[model samples]
Target: MLQKILRIPWIARRTNHNILQELGMKESQLLKNIKQLKLKYFGHVVRHNNLERLCLEGAVEGRRGRGRPRRRWTQDISDWLGFSVREASILSQDRDGFRSAVWEATSYSYKDPP
Candidate 1:
């Protein structure tokens, strides 16, 4: 998005970090913002927030729709952590572990925004 915003074509050979650096935007700042938002949202006790978190954690049971299952939120995070969603769910219990996992996931999948 940053590259496209700055008119940097996707075909360019520059790395994601390099493009952001040229645009005077620190990738770490974006990472920090994402972390802050995640922590704030999960820490809050609103009904909707709880529901959304539960959905992401796959705590709600329901019937399937069709063909292959859609990619899950926990799967994405677990892919970033190079592990399984079950383990990711377990780690989410610990505030610090969740943060670390997010950081790790971002560092790995930062270039490919979901």
Candidate 2:
């Protein structure tokens, strides 16, 4: 779709990375934004004693199929921030600390422009 918008022909045989470089697009910007949003929402949910928080805390009652247990949403948070969900939940209580942590976590996933 971006190629179509940029009117770049396939005949040129340009790679998506090349096109993105030409356009000066930060490849990981979208991923960074998504991670930041998810983290912020996580903090919001953690701060509230609501249904969403319950679900996030894995309070759902259901039997899994006979296979490996499915990864929970909290797994991604753990992977991104290098902190266990419980620790993250505790950290989220401090808005400034959580915000700084989120920024630090997402910042490492992208490169600064030269």
Candidate 3:
């Protein structure tokens, strides 16, 4: 539906396809909520005993895969912010700035697990 609206050629074999933003529409509000939560969780001021913090920051061991590895949330967040993990951590501390950045980033249509 979006492709037809955007007039993107079907055979172009393109990627990074953000049709909603192109049409001056906002990405889903849920995505904004997720982004806000991720940023806040990663930048918590104190230890909150939150499982998500550990899960997001922890590295799993003994991973074996035949093909491509699983796409990680951290990796996606980094990609969305155009930042290294360390940089993202630093920037996530600023709630207002990070919110704006999230709004800008949700416009990117990069296919997942890139």
Candidate 4:
């Protein structure tokens, strides 16, 4: 889509990185933003003692299906923060700490062209 917008043909051999650089875009901008938002929302939900939190924590029991186990939302949060879901939940209690952790977890640093 970007290539079409830029009128660059496939035969031009223009790399995606080059195109993104031309457009002044960080490659991970969209993904990073999504991660940041997800983390922040998770923190919000964790701070509350509601149905949402219970569901997120897998406290609401239900039947399991056959084959591979489904991945949980907290798993993604744990992967991103390099901490267990329980620890992350505890940290989320501290608003400032959670915010800083989310920022650090999702931040992307773009290197200047040489």
In angstroms, the error of model 3 at 54 is 0.8
lDDT for 20 in candidate 3 is 54
Model 3 compared with the native: what TM-score? 0.50
Candidate 2 lDDT trough over 10 residues, lowest sum? 105-114
* Candidate 4 minimal-lDDT segment of 10 residues: 105-114
The lDDT for every candidate, in the order shown, is 0.61, 0.86, 0.64, 0.85
Candidate 1 lDDT by residue in tens digits, 73-110: 44544555666756655666676777776666555454
Q: Against the hidden reference, what TM-scores do the models get? A: 0.42, 0.71, 0.50, 0.68
Ranking by lDDT: 2, 4, 3, 1
Q: Which of 2 and 4 is the better model by TM-score?
A: 2
Q: Candidate 4 versus the native: TM-score?
A: 0.68
Off by over 4 Å in 3: 1-49, 107-114
Off by over 4 Å in 4: 1-27, 60-63, 109-114
Candidate 2 regions with alpha-carbon error over 4 angstroms: 1-24, 109-114
Model 1 stretches astray by more than 4 angstroms = 1-23, 26-49, 57-69, 108-114
Worst lDDT 10-window in candidate 1: 39-48
> CA lDDT of 83 in candidate 3?
84
Residue 70 CA displacement from its true place in model 3, Å: 1.5
Per-residue lDDT of model 4, residues 63-82, tens digit only: 78899988987789999999
* RMSD after CA superposition, every candidate: 7.0, 4.2, 8.7, 5.1
lDDT of 3 by residue, 47-92 (tens): 3446766676677699677889878767877876788877766676
